[model samples]
Target: MGDLSGRTALVTGASRGIGRAIAERLAADGARVAVHYGGNEAAAKETVAAIGEERAFAVRADLSTPDAVDTLFARLDEEFDGLDILVNNAAIATSSDFENTTSEEFERIFTVNVQAPFFITQRALSRLRDGGRIVNISSGVTRIAMPEIITYSMTKGALDTFSRTLAQQLGPRGITVNTVAPGIIDTDVNASWLRGNPEAEAAAAARAALGRVGRPEDVADVVAFIASDDARWITADWIDVTGGSDL
Candidate 1:
């Protein structure tokens, strides 16, 4: 664990899956976390309870909406005197064949995956203390370009670029931004495939050098490193957390 006793962090998509794991990881390191969830208030509260209310709080914000982001930060500011870590982990996607992919579907994924993180960082900059860390959750699909989830891959690819560029822009401010791209993970988002479809899960697992699907904690560990002082020299870099699948 790193020394983060006085730091405060905001983690989006914290109601479940990788986001919840990241929030827990940060809290374990002693940072007070604002657990942001788009839906499922009960699940979000459960995350806070697991991490302890003294170290984590449940916050709700619909990232797909333009105005709700600012509203989210406004509440975060009211709770923490200064924000030290900003984790843009909130994202959404739907499975569809290329011909079946609709403009609405693509737009929805991009809005929440790309636009939300960009704007949320912009909106929350005022509260991000100097030397703070901003870690964006990306996907291995950007590198492997998964065929089934093409649109989702596109959104994550954009995030990799945004992480690099934003790091340069925030360099002068002493804030560092980086992206952590994870491979197929065993989470509720993927529970159907892992639980009911053994054949599908095995095929997915074969792609990873680890010989298994990733766990939420696997990705969370990488995010924690990027947010740590050990990575102070790293900026504008996209660190792959995909269990050697990209290789």
Candidate 2:
């Protein structure tokens, strides 16, 4: 049996991209996974199918809504008795720069990327088992200067702070709260600019010390390990899954 054979994990935004990869990896490790999606029911179902219907289920909640956390956990309560891992991976980004970013855009980004995760975890605490895991998916932009997505980077920074502080408070319960920051990965989100554009892809690859752009699975594997029993002592840490980008 896998180390997480009996565990149950909730991976937000598991409908696509890095979230989907994390959900698949967790399921492979023998955890029953709740594949949470913002609005894409089809993609969420595809994720479940990929992981096997028996091992995964889809839950939908538009995290931009104020009651999103309640809606999410209400659905979750119907499926699992308790949660062993919570992966806060749902987020949205805007390309608007500092000067162009409007109040509405900033609010929307913060609402989905920061507020949703915060409240979701707050509600999850009671359902989370004592020795549970909380993995917040952050971004390398928080470390590297990306002026184009300055607002997005700010949200990640807030998430990183949340992870560290929450880790300290939840230590007594044996709950580990940490953040995983990923560099550029070749996902659909980056497809418009990075996929067919050979020059752009090459430039992104060169930034990494590994001389290659990261894949969703690259970050997923690290998260799988962090969620396992092997990483019980690891908490409140920001683990970089950037493939040594800009290092």
Candidate 3:
């Protein structure tokens, strides 16, 4: 419903899962998309193919490294001189109890999930044109509090703060910053247990008021709106794509 013709967007971790869906959606809306991948060149190429290589290209960078972050921007500058929309959707999840989480694990997750995005946005400020949109793909765990991924949740909480603060900081430039938190999505990550297992699938579906597990497209649609000019007034907020879970 939103038009993005002639615009340019970047979607991190877009090789597969929700990120891939977001890339496809933006491309559908007529924005040239750059699909960022950590190390999956094959998957990235596949996504580009799905969106049409002429309209989509793949960029690779290990977000956990600061140098890699710089490299990513450098490559983006070469691929597209300016960016109209940025979706920070790349993240890693780890399951560890409060008593058992290791220092290394904590740092690794934060580096990839939190630190990278923090700097990525910082560096992107120059490349991001005025009136651009910044959409961070946060997680619903921030509100629901699943201890298994407490660290992951904490990272998203920090990202939420970043979004709110950046929204205000960049308002003068007409840039809108927001976060999209998705619930249990039926992606490859969840297919291991949520697919073909009626009991597991039913249990997951019961968690949402919609009585069904979410798909990547559900979140992608919302992101597409936030990226469009239509959502110019919506910022500094978190759009919960949780199917009303725990509500």
158-241: candidate 1 lDDT, tens digit per residue: 999999999999999889999898888989988876867989888878888878888999998888888889889989887777
Q: Tell me the tens digit of each residue's lDDT in model 3 across 151-232.
A: 8888899999989999999999999999999999998778888899999999999999999999999999999999998899
**Runs of candidate 3 exceeding 4 Å displacement:** none
Stretches > 4 Å off in candidate 1? none
Q: Rank all candidate structures by their lDDT, best first, as comma-separated numbers.
A: 2, 3, 1
**92-161 in candidate 2: lDDT tens per residue?**
9555899999999999999999999999999999999999999999999989999989999999999999
Candidate lDDT values, in order: 0.88, 0.94, 0.92
What's the CA RMSD of model 3 in angstroms? 0.9
TM-score winner? 2
TM-score of each: 0.96, 0.98, 0.98
lDDT for model 3 comes to 0.92
